[model samples]
Target: MKLHIVPARTGFQWVKLGAKTFFRQPLAMGGLFFMFMAAVSVLSLIPLLGTLISLALVPAATLGLMAASREAEQGRFPMPTLLVTAFRSGPANTRSILVLGAMYAAALMLVFGVGALLAPDVPAIEMPEGEVSPERVRAMFNNPGLWVALVLYVPVLMAFWHAPALVHWYGVSPFKSLFFSLMACWANKGAMLLYSLGWMAVIMMAGVVMNLLAVLLGGAALLNIVLYPMVLLLAAMFHTSIWFTVRDSFVTQEDRAA
Candidate 1:
């Protein structure tokens, strides 16, 4: 597939487009997002491997959301089953996303593995096995493991950023999709930089607004209680923005289909 070379300013437009798309189908999109999060949360509850499985499913879930966005664009409500479009499309599509998921899981595992290796003696909570205490959490932040994991996750993020869309939309293979996604990001790094900065600006503005509300209401607890929906809204928009970025990176739907 031929990648589109959009201007650096295009990133902002993608956010705008994402917002428009999300608003057009807010109920459907919101429900789908809730379902997605619920699924992830449930999967992450497993004893040891749950988190990895949840991470692996992320790409597939993301592709499903992209499909939902397309449906919303067509003025149709996205169905709950849209979450599994990647898996149900056909063997080829299923294989591509599954492989991508495996790679993502492996990469994340590698990141944590390296982190453990780097800080084998990192202390744990001195409590029940399944219960995490505040001291343990604080200690983890002061340890090397967190930083190592964060540093190692960058390449993994880059590799999987646009991979799901590439596979679902353009029928790209798993490994090639990773390469193309990386190249596409590198090529459009300037736009993405702007995009990231824009997100930070929005987040800052949200914080400002939250603080203002807290002060005006004379109770930070009140705003804290009410701000959850707003945060979820911003999160939905961010996920939608990811779809827009992927859409703009490739040829038009008709051309890509051909």
Candidate 2:
């Protein structure tokens, strides 16, 4: 089959495809959730191990892409079995995905460290006789150097924005994956920015809701359990959307035409 790269689709279409693919495979989706829980559990036990295991997060993120690709390859999108076959076929692709993921993590950590260093010292919050002042909190937000660091790090952020999908869909080398992912972001800057912003909005809303629920429920653990699966689900969908975009934008039909 020839690999024809398509133009980036609308966010709604990408998200719809992701939801459809996820809901179609219960066991596979369950397995993906299990892997995420296992990673979280392991990380909670050992911080260093968690950092190492973090490399797999992108591969976990790409599970939907793997499932979708396998279904397409087999000429059948069977509901219950899609994820199983996807996992079987994912070893090589997952390795590539992890390689890109590790590179991205390293880059992000370096950027974040630099940002932290450049940021001004945060003042200690002193409670008044009764309540903390909002003005005091707002005053801490005034750091130009930190802002500069953030601006400089945008390229690194953009590089990783679609990396998992690039690896999963294209099975490209790490260098090529990084190159194409960033280039795709550059080519479709507006769409990519909107995608990033939308993801942030979802995450922020989820956080707010979960915090509120925690206050009402009296145990944040329940909130964590609920949010964990949802986070994994959203991560899976986001990576799948990127996979579709990369498959459409980077992998050429001619290259696979042979």
Highest TM-score: give the candidate number. Answer: 1
Segments of candidate 1 deviating more than 4 angstroms: 119-144, 252-258
Candidate 1: worst-modelled 10 consecutive residues by lDDT: 122-131
Per-residue lDDT of candidate 1, residues 1-58 (tens digit)? 6878889998788777878999998988888888888888898789768888898899
Give a tens-digit lDDT track for model 2, residues 178-235: 6766777788765555556667777788788888988888666777678866777677
**TM-score of every model?**
0.85, 0.63
* For every candidate, C-alpha RMSD to the true structure in Å: 3.9, 5.9
TM-score of 1: 0.85
Native-to-model Cα distance after best TM-score fit, residue 44 in candidate 1, in Å: 2.0
**What is the lDDT, from 0 to 100, of the residue 135 in candidate 2?**
67
- The CA lDDT at 171 in model 2 is 65
* Candidate 2 colliding pairs: 6-248
Q: lDDT per prediction?
A: 0.84, 0.60
